[model samples]
Target: MTYSKTWQGFYELLDTVYRTGRPFAARALPIRLGDEEADRAIDLLYQPLRDGEGAVTGIFVGGYDVTEQVRSQAALRDSEDRYRTLLDSLDVGFCILEMKFDEADRAIDYRIAEANPAFARQTGADVAGLWVSEFAPDLERHWFDTYGRVALTGEPIHFENQADVFGRWFDVRALRIGEPAQAKVAVFFSDISDRKRMEEALRVLNASLEAQVAERTAERDQIWQASTDLFCVATLDGRLASLNPAWTTLLGWGEGELLGRPFLDFVHPDDVAATTAAAAGLARGEPQPNFENRYRHRDGSYRWLSWNAVPRNGRIYATVRDVTAVRAQAAALAEVEEALRQSQKMEAVGQLTGGVAHDFNNLLTIIRSSVDFLRRPELPEARKRRYLDAVSDTVDRAAKLTGQLLAFARRQALSPAVFDVGEKVRGVADMVDTVTGARVRVVVAVPDHPCFVRADLSQFETALINMAVNARDAMDGEGTLTLTLTCGTAMPPIRGHAGSQNAFAAISLADTGPGVPPDLIGRIFEPFFTTKEVGRGTGLGLSQVFGFAKQSGGDVDVTSSPGRGATFTLYLPEAPAALEADDRSAAAASVSPIGAGESVLVVEDNIEVGRFCTQILQDLGYRTTWATNAEEALERLGPDGAGFDVVFSDVVMPGMGGLALAHELRRRMPTLPVVLASGYSHVLAQDDAHGFELLHKPYSAEQLGHILRRVTRPGRPRRTA
Candidate 1:
């Protein structure tokens, strides 16, 4: 029989069964009945009837329709596939776990059975089909306990917790998936470690901020209560808003009395205006670091207050201190300074008096003794001449003593002339080597160019000698003295005087000797202030140097260190080098001393000195005329000074001083030579002689004769017949 018309699948099955001599069955096999558009599914079975040899056979089939069942199964599988895909796509992790139980029925461990892709990411590991104990053996027991309880009781749970073994925190939801006997759970979780860490940092920061705020408050309170200076806060309108306890302690005013009142009310009447001005400044946001004013105290007295204040947020924060004691101390210091100056002056005077008495008495002793010896009637000619020479030498010594005193006073007459400082220093170096002894070496250092200064040549040389002698004494005559000359330099501040930026010539003498002691350096220029033994020095050397430097428009400074050495620098204002040639020419053309009956008009206030001066001029081959005063001398000159070749006048005469007389003569007789003589004259000391020749008192007959002869030199401007 052919079943191909009924169902192709059945026909095929029957054919196979017939060929194999077996019966066949089919399930859900599609067939068309009577040419229908849709085919029907059926379950069929085929069996074949076989002969004894099992070769040829006829087949029989059994069948049933199964279209609905097949379709339902397909639909269910499609829905399951979709559910798996949804789980895999979620950000949250999802997994199914099968719990393992021990003999006591307690869930001990779990194996991951099913997982989504997110499960591996959230857990930082792919644990599917692996026991939790195998991967995370150090997992906390609480995890097992919580998940096991949920599975056993079929209870769902939601929690956020750290899994220490995984080093992460999780937000987890777990529920039993089936019957409690199944011991299975479905878990949904997400990694929450970053959220947890941020929360923890915020918590720590909040705690620290609170602690810092409390600490600052405590510190402010401590400073407010403990500070001795008055601390206060005031409004812009000048009312005291708050005050520290220092106010009560310092001004004897209670806090209540001072608060909420205009601060100017406590100010002194004389200081109220100033205090108001200061308040205005503070309101403008100006900081007043040190403003002083007086405040009325509770004791009916006024106290000086110094305020340091700043403005912020329409308020003034101020710190004030009582400065009454400071003011009083400053006044007292002023008085003390005056007293110290007076004491220093008196001490200097005492030293001068002692020195003068000591030196003069010695000189007077020689004179007195020599005069006494000469007074003997039977004195030999040789002895008489020796006594006369001794008297003359003593007089010379007295005059030198007076001159040194006058030099220290800056009251000695000076004849300033321009000369090269380098050449002068070099010249002094030779003498310094001799004065310092053979054991001491002298070094002279000078620049190639000339440095000149206008100063008294004699005084300048004397100052150099004094310094050299001082250096030798300091070295004990066994060290080196370096003389350095620098041109085009500036004066540095010395002895508290201001420095000069003007060009200057610097002459420095450095000595390798035991240096000046720090304590004595300041007073080294004080007259009679010496470190030497009593008979060794007169102590006027450095003093004369100081006076000379000051009077010559310059300064002297010394720098020293103990056990090292000392350097003394003399700074003089630089003069033009153009004067050097003129000085040299003048020095070259100097005249001889022997006079040849030159007429001299002598003006002297003392009759004895007048007579003596005339006699000396007459003996020097100069015809002399005497006048008691400048007027008499002018009258003797007869308005033109015609008869006199030179006017030898005392500088400190009674009226119309020598300087005035010289000016008068220059006006009347411009060609007549004027020679000024003075032992000590204020006019000569303070001002120059206006081109008049100067002859110092106590000058030797040779000196007087020389100056007169030079002024009377023929063919010279002042050398008229």
Candidate 2:
């Protein structure tokens, strides 16, 4: 063939081909089949020629009838390129494994085209065209068997297999690359070590979390069971659903008795309304801050209950506190406080009476003595009768006035005796209905058996009546009044210690009425303190009970809150059968006249008292001396004066009180008899009878005579008779 290329251009093209070392093709624009043809056909291709030294020599137009062969070669090259690209780009380890049946059906051969980076890194060896048994001997059986199955059956196999290669792992699949047993089987493998590590880590974390939850659950159970506060779960319908040990213990009920039962079954009837309201609020998801109510115990006694709860897990989880003991203590404390306040008021009143009595006794002494001298039997009988009548009138007026003062002071001369308390409770109950009118129901639950206490019968009845009256006032003649009398072991004194433990009776007066006024409730027991109109009450009822109870080794208590009625309880020492029945004979009889040869010393700050005492002593056949105060008495008993046989001194003189003078006088005349005279009971100091004779003043000449005879006469017992 002839070519148009110049010699230099031809050599240049040849150099280019030789330098690049790649195939190149070119084509002409068109070809014409004319009759005249050239001596050669041109080949539009570039090629390089090499010389003996292996250097590129020249471009050559070496034409031949090789069109068919050229097309075939080009096609082969294109397929080879595609195959090489696939081998390089694949991620799975592609090994063209050949199964073999040797001496045993085990040994295998591996003629890999090329392995990916994954397979190369796993084995740490370039393993193309390697025997399968030599490269990985342990995998010979499994690999050949899997490869054989897939290659022969034209099926794909997916399974897990392990390899002890770099970063050891499990591989997933084996499949045939081509059709039939003659073809290479592809075994695809991946390093799954990282995935396995992640799974193991997750398992350990789950175990730890489960352990933590178990521990927390155990702790919660322990708290629920061991706590003193009752822990419980209730349904929305206010049924007792579940409870801990504390609930049963506190309520004194068995588990069977409480579970699935309505909570209201155990509530105090009077408190049910408020409890129902609180439960309703809780059901509506209201956060009730510590709800308070009362629950009836198994013994039919009511106890206070306080509770707080939360709604969670479709149930009400709650903590209940049996505040009965605390409530009782608080009630007892309030009662004690009320009693103490009342007692203080009574003491204050007594102090006022004492001051008045100190002055009044002197005046009474003068009058009594003048009246006594007028009846000396030296005058006519008619005139003497008139004088005696006048004396009688004076005595009657004085007795009435003194009685009022004693009532106000709460320390009248009471003769306490062993008797049934149930009668008094009933007596008060009978009057309660009359006083409270038809609007109130009065129930007297007095015990049929004797519930006994040692209290003055009159005072006891009066206290009961007072409480009933107060209840009537509170109810405004409406609602129910319950007077309950029961006996029990002695409780600690409602106030201070009332001796040691003693048999006691509890008289409870409960009223369903308007509660005490919130503001004035605390001060109701103050002297002259009243909730009624001026004519209705003197306000000394509670105060008198307070003093009388304490003095008799007992206490009085009361409770009232807003919107709730009032309850008053009296706790008194039970009279013992062994003790003398309150010495009733002592309550009777007037003061006795003085016997012969008793010398008396009269000490007073008031002029009228001193002079009268002198006259009475002389009239009673006793030598008498008078002194204005303790100082004057001490001087009169000094070396200049002959000492009297007995010293009669008035407490509360100008310079010193009677106790101090007694201390002073007893220093010199320790054995000499001294009697302290006062108009009122001794409410000044803790003890008015501290190692001396105490004479309640406002006594007649006859009383003066008795005091002297009782002290001065030998082998004589002390008595007013």
Candidate 3:
């Protein structure tokens, strides 16, 4: 066989085998089978052929068809190179670890035998050929145990863990790859720090979103439950879907009872139509704002509810407020406003009437005296006497009219004294009958025991008479008029007087006449207000009753229903039982004779009044001095002036009024008698005349003489009756 130059090395190997008397074998030797252009590989065995004597002979060569074997070796080398290249190119870290065990066959540590570039990069350490504990001294023992188990059991394990020392997270896969006697674990892992951070961020974001949702839900729930106003969600068909606790608190119904029920069921019968309309409007997407209706309370009463509602998503959300108390307050305010207006009207009328009455009284005084003088004419013919008599009667009528005006204005001077109201009613029974006329019956009903009150006896009788006359007119002069006396512990509130807590006496004058109208009830006590026709009644009758009652620190009230007749009750503070005996009688009935030697000072603002007063004093046999005003009176009674035994002053003077003069005189001459007279002075109206004698105007000579003598007498009582 022809051999190629590639066989020269083989021939040399064979020659050495013969010389050494040994056999040589070449596993895969390259031999040229054909020409160089088509060369093939061969494996040859070269051996020395020896005789039995063990001497070297010609070499025997053995040839094998090992072309595939040589080719297979080359392929294996290529595969190994590819594998190493694949491992180096991988992004994941890779390592082969040999697990070391203790005497107990328990895994203690792991030695890293091989590591790829990725492993070094991930761990930030060059750890090949080093123990895992050496590379990461603080590595967990669980890592070694896990890898050891995988090597012993030939099981592959996958896990994720953080490397605190390297500040990295990794996803590691450990597998047994070598023989069990020399156990080795291949660990493949990746640096998963970015993925872990991303996953953590996503988790935090989801948690935050969940927390926000929870917070919003809680806020919505809080608002729904905590609101005081009635809050509800109802379907467009009026079925209540939800209601807050306020509905239970305000309407006295449980939430379960109200929800899922028709909302209109709880509405007041009269308000149901309106509530239904409002709901219909809300269903049409038109917002109902401040719509008002009444709802029935659990107590069978109705409460006003104001509602605001809107429609959204086939539901009506509504809020309601209870306005029952607000409505009541508004009504009360209206009543108060009306009462205030009536009071103002009465005040204005009182001022006007009071001014007129004061002047009218003075004129009546002049006329009455002139008429009295004319009636005493000695040359009186029969016709002249008749005319004078008529004049006197007319003067009397004019004086009575002025008195009524003064009473209506509540400015009349009241001479209040303690007297039995029962006796007074009995005593005035005849007068009340006369005023009521024969067509009417006057009945006096008095208790057996005396009921005492501090009031002007004359004015009290007059008030009784005036009420009788008014009742007579109301009944057309044909009804029963009853005057009854009773006592009580407390009295109801009146216009000018607060309600009383003390015992009081009542003089009730009930008449079987037509009752007063409801609309006119409040106006009945007002001055000059009347329901009768013009000329049929003076309208001052009830006014006098009202004024007299108020002036005596008491009040008069009337109760009547239309067509049921009327009763007028006069409430006055009861007098102490002890005072009833002393003040039982009226002011001394008979006048005393004038004090002949006494001097008198008459002070009057009106010239006619002054002259009349001084003339009466002179006629009563007293030396008199007259002053036109309080100042003039004070001047006449000064220390240097001709002083009088007693000083008389008119109360309603222009400057330095008589009350002021009396106060000053009392201070200077405490024992000196001072008498003040007025038709209707503010001082008398205020009930401030004390420590001095007071005489009302339009007094006759006899009354003046009696008062003057009583005041001028020495050692007189400091306080007069």
Candidate 4:
């Protein structure tokens, strides 16, 4: 009879029958059992069937699960094929165990069910169907415990051993083959010796790498300590974080003393603002160029430092070099530059003076002649008075012109002494209120403490007032003038010259005026250059201030931009003195009576000036001789020319200047009195009675007499020609 089940399933059902009375037909279908190992089917075919007539009849039919019997046979054959496949194809070792019972009905041993050839390689045993514990007695204590547990529990147990086994590490997995009550367990193992050895090697390598890192770190620390430059780290707010030993050695501060202090505390107080700003910028990730500033050393003195700063990883890193010597050299360079500039300026002025005097003296000659002719008794008193007044006014104009020239040339003399600049500025504040009209507001920002400077008191005050007036004009007489005194003790050297050292004190005069035109700022201090209309300004105001400051051993600088108002800085070298109002000069408003008598020697390259000088002296009742040059004057003094009472020489001439002549005369005659006349500052400074008395040019008859009197009368002595 045909069954509606697979052949294997039909066989499985037949195996279950014990007292079956009939044969049956069944249906069968295929079913999977193990991965690539077995298959099964089920069917209802079993025993034989009988008919009612007592003879065998048609067999009974039923659908049955016959999958297992068919599958079992297939599996056995497949297992043999797999056994060969595993032996040739698997990379890892494989083993199988079979159950063996003892005579008392207890499992006493286990046999090799079937194993691929690799099992022999794992263990040197060739015998099949034998107990693993017996074959390898060394594994009895080890593998037996896990094997028995698995065999009874029907669960898998996996183990690993990096210890050399058969010359290599091995990992094994064991499991029971049947139910929990089974005595057979299969164990599989593989070799992983290479991975284990590699791991151990890597651990050693990591330890070596750590040691090398430590060595490198020590070397780097040694190098850092040996370096000469000062390296430091600070917070964004300029609080010191870390510093090298060099900082303490060079700066005289102990490490512990420097820590937790504001980095700017070690900086000169005046430089704190700049240092703070730079640090803040660095903290915000902005790099700083090598900027010069002042820092306080362990001693109570300040020194220069130049440094570059950058912020890295939330910390400020700065490398600094002591720049005090460099700064000093730079200051010296600046002084040299200033000297050169002054020399060139003086040369130009001297040339201008010579040219002007040569040309203008001829005109003066005619004017003097006309005036002399008019002074005769024939002319009416009214016309005579008018002519006299006209001549006097013309002479005054010439004098004023010369004075302006002197201001430009910086030749005008200044009586210098120490004075308090703060009080001087304050004194001007009250005057500014009236000069600039009530509409203008003036505030003096002078410090309470004394700020002393060595300079010409009148000139300094005059320069400051001039600056204020200019500021007031810029503001149309309605703005503020703030005079602030700032200490410049630690200012960096300027213009690479020690002489160009920033003044010890700075008096800044600022105004809220419409700012100066950028184009005019540079030229404002030039003589006769002005922004005001023709009639409004002489343009000599700033030139005078500039000349005065330079002559007084100081400088003037201006900062201005369109719409930003303006500030004028008067940098005056400091002197130890009280910073209060100083006394005014006693001769400030003196009439200065002219001198009479005494023989005079006048040297003028221009014939007209020579004659004018001779005539003026003669009219004043003094003996005199005129020379066109130094050579002619020397001859006059040597007895061939007229005997001289006192020598007066023009600075610029065809042969030699008055300064050189004066020095030569000082050597020749020793006590021979000489006077130097110039319209330029270079001439005046060239010899400050390093040889003879200095006299500025463009003098009137009265001025000429006055200087002569002052020179002739030393300690109240006088002479008559």
Candidate 5:
């Protein structure tokens, strides 16, 4: 074969071998084959072409063709170069591990047979050809077992694990490489340090989110379950969707009973309309900040409920409160206010009446004494008639003024007894008619059943008469006067008296006449406060009625509208069934003239009154001594009152009052009979004249004589000296 330029080096090698007569060798020698575009590889062995000699002549071209083998080797070398480049460029760590085992087939350590550049970067150290225990003495045995198991079982495992030695985390995939007897594992891993940190951060964030969720949920639940007020969620259709336990606690109803039911179901019938209206407002997206209505309880009683509600998202969130007790307290407060008003009114009236009564009584006493003298039959006929007529008119006016004063003062002695008010009203009907006149019609509208009251009979009659007169005057003496008597357990509240819860008799005198003006109605019951002309009225009629009703443990109320009509109602407490009428007729009988020759001491503050008293006593066959005041009377009676069989004294005196004198006389000589007299005195009004024989003022000679006989009667009980 002809050698080409490519074979020149081989030919030179062959020439040398021939000149030295020795063998020649050529490794991976190239040869051109017939001008082909490819080259061939060969490993040549050249020996000297000599027979039985060690000398080499021409090279022995007997070597096998290594072209295919060389090509394959070159290809494999290129591929291995690419693989090393790829491994060095990768972000993952790559290693090949071989497990070392003892004779017992137990693996105790692992060796890294191969490692990539990334593996060194990940571990921060050289690990190839090093034992895992030498690199990290604390490496877990699982690493050895995992490699051994992969080598022995030919199974692949993918896992993530931390290598604390380098404070790094890795995601590793291991598989058996080569034959099972190799006991080697090829592992591909990623240095997940940054990924591990991110994962830990995500875990902490998730944990914080969960904690916040739990905290919010706990707070919401606490508010829902712990509130005492009725917290509820309801639908737009007025149905209760859910309610707190307060529903059951406050309304005496279970939650089950309230939920799913229309909210109006619990409303009282009278309040349903209002509640429905409010619900409509809520449905229209209007919030009810405060709404009140009565709700029926489970026990059938009604309770007042106050609600504050807001509507949103087709539902209502509402808070409710039971206000029944608050309502009751408000009512009680109103009643107390009314009672206070009444008491204040009475107090004001009492002060006014007491202020004028004392002076008016003195004037009346003078008029009465003058009238008594003018009535004597010894006077000339014409003079007697004229003086009697004039005096009689003056006495009438004086008596009326005194009566009014006593009535307004609430000191008119009342004989309160159980009497049928219906009967009393009937008895006074004729009198009321007479006062009202023929122009006015008097109608008595009493119930068939007797309405009995524990009040003074004459005062009740007088009250009726006063009311009648007021009605007649209001009507201008032409309207209908209706006297309606009603009996019931509840009476309207009256000024100056607490409303009685017991049965009461309401005698209302309604007049179809021009009513008193609204402004004057309150003052109508005030003494001397009248709407009539000054000379036409004393203004004490209504005040008398008020005083009498109040003193009798009752009250009077007036309803009037200007230019319309007026009503005067008297409320009297009812009496028990088994009441007996008082016998006042015996007390009204005239006194007997049975005075013996008894000595008397008369005390009077007025000069005329003192002389008249002594003269009357002497004319009644009683030895009399006169004194201008209680002090003089006591002096005349002496310390032991030896000259007096009875002591008579005026109650209201200058130096010492009769009551005080009586007390002093009793202390000095208790056996002396002392009598006290007065037209109107504060002491007599207080019932402080109990120990003495009380005599009213303007007493006649016959009355004085009778009183003296009674006091000086023999064997009568006398106080000891």
Candidate 6:
């Protein structure tokens, strides 16, 4: 019997049995057979040995070595500790699902037997040891089936599916873990929601890109098919590669016939060189500016083609437009313009000849009769004076008739001065009252404020009277005439003349009378072109108004329709009130009377007229010199005519005209005074008379004497037209 630290527990058990006369057992009791031997485990049992009387007796022990069994249990416990650590540390959700079956052996539901910590984190619920139906009542049945099949068949499956009940996608691998009858499956799963969303976004983006590509292709094709201009692509050497549908529509050439052919082959022979040059430039990476050439059509005719081309990637893209109609229109316009000019020339000639023949004959008749009566030797002095006066009056009438013609032609000498238009219009209205008769009422609408214009005062008054007379006649002497004066107004376009923004005065004369007929309004201003019966009008009234307006740097506009009456508006450039004040002061200054012995140079082309002019100057007590032409007048002036007080020359003549002579004389002697006289000069009509004193032909002796005296005065400034 031995007792030591290693076998102390076994000794205690054996001692208890012996002291109490009881038996006991001790399993897995530790003991050492020897100090050097390895530790061993033993199972020990104690029992009492007694006689038949059953009194206490000696003890008996029995037991076996359990070292191997104890070692095996220790190894198993260590393995289980490592397995639990792996499950707790894993990121993937781990669970064992026990699938339940119905009477038909079909998978009905699943119970979660075991689950790791990550399983609750992934599924958002701690579902271990619970039936899946209790937590996710609406979970899809396929989940049960999928795991059930793995459990029933002892097979493993890997899959990714969305758990809609939890709004999460899972990547899962499930395998049967126990026996087939157990219906348990071990599942490994991970939440793949972020990856799944990214994949879906990529798929949608791909679909959008495809749709955009298809839409752009459709749009480009539509433009190509529906365009009106020819569109084509060509090689650097001018061979056609592709052409839009417009090419066939415009030139009658099919794509099959034109493709792969040099485009210049269809060009007109005259246009080939230009087309080649343009194509060469485009090939040099220089875009071609728009150019025009001719192309041969299917009918063997040529069409004008305007081409614009650009270069890209060694190819030329061009757009061509057919301009044949445009070219034809331009040609026709030129012809129409030329014909119109000729017709206007002929019409003017006819009007001038007829008017002259009719009016001049009457003037000549009076002159002829006056001459015959003076031929009578027995005529009384009073009778002779009467005939002489008749001759003088007839000459005056003939001169006035010629002046009217010049005025109608817009070729009259104008003496422009600044004056208030409102005042002048009011004064003319008084005269119009008598002219229009008692049957017609005159209404004047003039602003109290003065409106000024720089124009010929006499011509302005004459224009007003002419228009008033015209209105009166149109009204047959029995309608209202309204005269309105407006200042600071712009001129609108009239009779094809462009408008202006400069300040202007508009004097409008409106009449309540039958308006001018539409068809005749265009020719109403033509000379001798009257709407009235032959004896009633000479048709020069409105023409004079037109001429006056243009010569004064303005325009006239007429508005009328059938039964709406007529309004004639005269637009004149407005003049500042300061100019009006200055002109008034100058006009107030007295003009010096005719200077005695003032020498005058009279240049006249007509022999008799020249004689009459010199005679009139001589009778006015002035020394006179006469030249038949402007060239002779210059010669007579001797380069510097120191003796002459003034030079009076006619405007229109052969070779050098009077205006040229005046300009030359002025250049030679800047201080020399010059007076020009013209009946009808185109130069004077189109432009102002170059700031020289001008006298219309058929002048009275008083007019001639007055102009010479004023210009030749010692201290007076040179008088201007």
Cα-based lDDT at residue 226, candidate 1: 44
**Stretches of model 3 off by over 4 angstroms after superposition:** 1-380, 494-498, 579-588, 592-597, 639-643, 713-721
**Model 3: per-residue Cα lDDT over 228-324, one tens digit each:** 5576768999999977777778888888888798978888888888888888888789988788988877777788987767776577766676778
Best by lDDT: 1
In candidate 5, position 460 carries an lDDT of 83
* Residues 1-721, model 5: lDDT tens digits: 3345767776677667778776767777776567667667767787677655654435565665788777656655543443443344334567778888887767888888888787788788897998878868887777677788878887777777787677778776676655677787767666677644111000000012322443333423433454445667689999999776767877899988888999888888888888888999989999886689998889998889778777765777676766677799889999999999999889876766664575467556766776676768686778767765665566555655665667667776454567888888888998998888999998888889877787767778888898898888888889789999999757766654457678888899999988877777667888876677745676778888987877777788988887779989988888876455555334434446556777777888888887877777777787777888776776666666756678888888887898899888888877778888788776566453555777665555666777777677668654322
Model 1 C-alpha RMSD to native: 27.6
lDDT of 6 at 168: 93
Output the worst ten-in-a-row residue range by lDDT, candidate 1. 198-207
* Per-prediction TM-score: 0.61, 0.36, 0.50, 0.42, 0.44, 0.58
Instruction: Give a tens-digit lDDT track for model 6, residues 1-721.
Output: 3333756766667667777888888778766665535657788879977778986667889968898877766654443333344345444577878889987778999999888887899888888999988988887778778888888887677778887867799877676654778787767677778753111000000012322433334424543554456767689999999787877887888899899999888998988898888888888888774689998878888889777676765777666667788789889999999999999999899887998899899889999989999999999999999999999899888876676677776777776778899999999999999999999999999999989898888889888998999999999999899999999999999978899999999999999998989888888777777888977877777888888888788989999988979999999999877432544224323553355887788888888888988888888888888888888877777756747778988898888899999999989978888999887788887776788888776777777777777677667444332
Residue-by-residue lDDT tens digits, candidate 4, 150-236: 676666766677533356677666656545444756555666665421110000000123224333334234434543457676777
* Candidate-wise lDDT, in order: 0.79, 0.63, 0.72, 0.65, 0.72, 0.78
Q: lDDT of model 2 at residue 81?
A: 41
User: Could you arrange the candidates by lDDT from highest to lowest?
Assistant: 1, 6, 5, 3, 4, 2
RMSD of each: 27.6, 34.6, 36.5, 32.8, 37.7, 28.7
lDDT of 5 at 185: 72
Consecutive 10-residue window with the lowest summed lDDT within model 5? 198-207
Locate the minimum summed-lDDT window of 10 residues in model 3.
198-207
Total clashing residue pairs per candidate?
12, 2, 0, 47, 7, 0
Error of 5 at 356 (Å): 6.5
Q: Give the Å shift of residue 555 in candidate 4.
A: 3.0
